[model samples]
Target: MKLHPVLVLDRTYTPVSIFSHKKAFILDLLNKCEVLQYYKSIKLSSPTMDYPAPLVIRIPVLLRHWQSPTPTRRAVFIRDNFTCAYCGKIVKDNNATIDHVLPKSRGGTWSWTNLVTCCNECNQKKGNRLPEEAGMPLLYKPKRPSSFQIALNRWRNKINREFLEALSLYGIIVDKKKLPEGSR
Candidate 1:
């Protein structure tokens, strides 16, 4: 019951984080946040009255500073949806290897635009070679992902569909089809 997920939002209603229901309810109790939505109508009884469990809550100040994930192995794989850049094969992150789009030997750097995630087989096949040289081509050009994009992509699966729908009402569209097969 307490383990249910809760979406935390800023005063402006931008999503800030996901907290457990217990913490979210605590926030409501402390007057730190206002409940915006409830996961269920079923309420918990206290000495005073019924407390509706929160599924989403909003705070009272703008959260201008949003935390973004740094570019790392897991970040790259998640950003790429664990798909090979050249072959578009859906694979697990454990099986994915970071490949330099322009081979490091050819002066490629380890930045987002130059790095892509691929399966070990593809990495071996394309070893130190340009995609074209390896008779393969990238399915899409890589870019440095925004922190919001990175976090969203990371917790994509953990996000409830109802929460996503609620976000949609605020004009945030998360398209999973443009990404790999396994992602929502």
Candidate 2:
């Protein structure tokens, strides 16, 4: 069966993480979490009972510690909104390349601040040189995204109006138009 992800919020209503629907359902069954919303068209059935598939769940306690995800090619691309950092051209995933703001040859570590999503042309043009050295200034400064931000971006396509509304109740405002086609 295809496993759908469920948004997980803390007691304070802050999104903390994501869990598989099955995991979220189990959390609900064990009283570990409260179901906030359910998938409209999905249902989980058993021999004795049928349950709605959870789209969002909330835990009873606040989670204080969470680890940030390591910067990766896809994550960098997503963070940059698939737009080249140097030229501002939107590129497809297949054509997107990760460029080091400070060239790797110049002792640049592969960190979030150093990496950027760039198109092949920009990558080739800025090869082995610093952004300033190549006369290409970054449009925006790159920084480490919070763990929740990473999770939200990764699961953006699965977020719907209901989930967004629930998030907004907690002061998390996501642009509906930016969501993937069907989700909006």
lDDT on C-alpha atoms for all candidate structures: 0.77, 0.83
Per-residue lDDT tens digits of candidate 2, residues 99-123? 9888888899899999999999999
Q: Pick the candidate with the highest lDDT.
A: 2
- Give candidate 2 misplaced runs (Cα > 4 Å): 1-5, 37-42, 60-67
- RMSD to the hidden true structure, all candidates: 3.9, 2.8
Go through the candidates in order and give the clash count of each: 0, 0
List TM-score per model, in order: 0.73, 0.79
lDDT accuracy of residue 50 in candidate 2: 83
True lDDT of residue 95, candidate 1: 85
Question: Could you tell me the lDDT of residue 169 within candidate 2?
Answer: 69
Worst 10 residues of 2 by lDDT: 160-169
